[model samples]
Target: MKKFLTLLLAVLMIASMASCAGGEGGKFELGLVTDLGTIDDKSFNQGAWEGLVQYATEKNVSHKYYQPTEQSDDAYLTGIDLAVKGGAKVIVTPGYLFEVPIFIAQDKYPDVNFILIDGEPHNADYSTYSTSANAVGILYAEDQAGFLAGYAAVKDGYRSLGFVGGMAVPAVVRYGYGFIQGAEYAGGELGLAAGDLDIKYHYTGGFAATPEAQALAASWYNDGTEVIFACGGAVGNSVMAAAEQAGAKVIGVDVDQSSESATVITSAMKGLKASVYSVITDYYAGSFPGGRTLVFEAKNNGVGLPMDSSQFRSFSQSDYDAVYAKLAGGEIPRMTELDEKGSPSVVPVEISTVTEVA
Candidate 1:
């Protein structure tokens, strides 16, 4: 009886040690909850995942990502729940859609740290704004990125430019506004009057790469618009398709999408990967700026055009450097605050022919 009891005690000790080492195949310390997309969407999700992967690999930490079953608040919350169950100490949620969901999860799982990108946590009706001590919000100066793309396009000899936005959301609105300003600035630099530059701006009212978006892009390209800055999520894909068919140039948004299509001249990029990596690093270093919103801009190398891949005729890297320095040094003006209707309150450039297509 004594020998049998000793063997059982040894087995129980081994089981306890195994549990402490993390159950099953070991729990992932870092988790990413994708917002309505796959890890390789080549946009928001991909950018965040790339950062997570880079940090995890360098630190030799376990990380994984979970895609929600649907694009509803409940589905997103469920994704967070799953990540926590998988031993995720830190969770990264990308996109504005997670705003409400993260608001709920922050209180529900106070022990879990959250990195909400592109948005802050709020209630469904936005009547309540709260950032728990365990969460931080990340925002970018998207207007700066858009400005770079516009200036590059004009300097590259594209006189007639167009902007096809996915939706009239705040981010998209800022991109359009900055594009117009940048083009106007370039016109001044090149000795062209305001009316000499023609810009067609339209919002597609949705973020998908739908047939209607493609049709609208096709119309713009067919009408002699030399380059169209496609500033939306999957909406850029539609514009790229149209540009390819029409042999027109395109400016990509969000990330460097030059690899997606040959027609892509350059991309107005936000440092999604860099921001994500920085936030995660801070979390591990015990310096996480919890309960605060972080803004990334040109001063921190947060937004710019992919210079190496840009197909510019005379706008060399030096030209880009000068403009970027001006922007960083506050020599260039940023876009005005967006109104409730998602429109810029101020328009610096006299866009002679701004049209809104249904």
Candidate 2:
């Protein structure tokens, strides 16, 4: 009888330890790695993090996140491995910064599932790193969202605008190109003359939050550009600051920044939260969108203008309704794929030639 009691106690202790180590009664654990930033940058990283948080809360699952201290590749992998070692069944990487590390992690821990946002790990030979079959990639139709914002800017009577970009990547260029197209389309539809509104563009070549963005934006504001569109990760915050200080309007990116950038006009938002939330929920259901590259467009509610209170509080209901109808009716075309290798493709909506500067 004493021997039986001892075995039973041992079993109970083991079960308790497992439960304590894992989140939510031993249910599958989820984890996220941010890209050289925190989880609350009010931007891309934040949007992805929010989605996971909401899903975990709703599903009563276990999850955690770790931001890198040194903000290097080694630091990123260490944070990711920390979660994996802690028994995370599914790990999420927030940005393209993790392209290389995720590729390595997938091979190192074949049993773990990975969700990579905004990037895929591929070698020069077009061969993906030897990764498990459990990894998935999530991308957005950012060009389309940028198009909508540009169209709305013109419709709202802001012709001369400025574009501030974080990096000269595909995503940033997509937003830039789409905005130009939307403005051109609006000018034609509104019967406005060409060259009525001039657009000045600049790229900071970095994603970190910096005062340099504000300084760049200030120069444009001084040059009479009344509205600005900023797409840098942390650099965007500086743009918003300049807009607020100069009493000019700004457009935000990734998530809705109307609330975060309250002094700004609106944001060209990707449904990052929804995408993140969907991945986590799928994992719980054993139907994660693994081994696939998921592309979300405006048609999928994956991209749109901001409706957050900070953005729309002062906007009349009719203004919101009008802009929304235009987007929904396909009168607005958001650019998705651009042919330009490192820059945004310039389709002449108005000007025949466009010069890119960084």
Candidate 3:
């Protein structure tokens, strides 16, 4: 009788502990739904995943990521459904592509907290927009990141440059415009003559690393373009391949790619990992900023360049900090992806000839 009582008590204790560790419904308390790319793409997905992994490992929490079978609204929603079914209390979705799916999923899974990066929730037509109490939207100052890359490049003596963006998406547009602006700012400091700088800009129409992107990058390098800002997702891989062949320099985007290639001088990084981690911290602390759009900018360490790893011959860490201070203080002009006319336009610089390629 005594043994039976002891065994029963032990079993109850074990069950209670299991229930406590298993989270709300399943095993994972945190979840991530990748956007159109694998987690190892070393871009948006990877950056967000790193943040989740860092937090989960530290707190001994269980986390998982779901990859959609296709890039579609339905597919992304299905991924979200899987995460919710797996007992995720908070789900992280990277990129603006998840805007509509999250918009729908927020209502469908009102109990699940969502961390939507780079966009806010909106309907398919974008006429109606709302973020439920369970979701928080995240946007980065991509322009600031791009500006650092361009400023450093010109200061390091790169006279000719190129920008090959994946698509004319808002984020990409912002980076492109900022890169041009940063170069012009540096040129003004250097008192460079007008037309001494040439910039070739093009959009690949897609984010995939097509052979065409590589060929175009190679052409730019051959035509005297010194460094190219690869602002697209996998499109950076195409540009890196071209740089390897031409022995030219390249600037990476989204995350640090200095380790990915020898030709990569620096990267325009969205503080993806930091932003995601901070939000997850808030979610677990019962202070998640639901229905709020959090903008990460230089003022908040949302964007920057990996100066320690950057291969700049002239640009130093002090130079980076000085410019970064101006940015954080809002000395630079406010960069917007679209002008008041709702069209993409570059505030042209007289020193550089920007040839926009179709």
* lDDT, candidate 1, 1-358, per-residue tens: 9999999999999989877456436689999999977989899999999999999999999999998999999999999998998899999999989999999999999999999999999999999999999999998888888888888888888888999888788888888888877887887888886577888888888889898989988998899899999988889999999998999989999999999999999999999999999999999999999999898888899898888998888999999999999999989978857755555335667633455454
CA lDDT of every candidate: 0.89, 0.76, 0.91
Query: Each model's RMSD to truth, in Å?
Result: 6.6, 7.3, 7.6
- Best-to-worst order by lDDT is 3, 1, 2
Clashing pairs in 2: 144-334
Clashes of 2: 1
Candidate 1 accuracy as lDDT: 0.89
Task: State the lDDT of candidate 2 residue by residue for 138-215, as single tens digits.
Answer: 888777788777777877787788788877788888888888887777677788875686787778988876777778
In model 3, what lDDT does residue 66 have?
Answer: 93
lDDT of 3 by residue, 28-107 (tens): 78999999878898888999999999999999999999999999999999999889988899999998999999999999
TM-score of each: 0.90, 0.82, 0.90
Where is the poorest 10-residue window by lDDT in model 3?
337-346
| Candidate 1 local Cα displacement, residue 61, angstroms | 0.4
TM-score of 3: 0.90
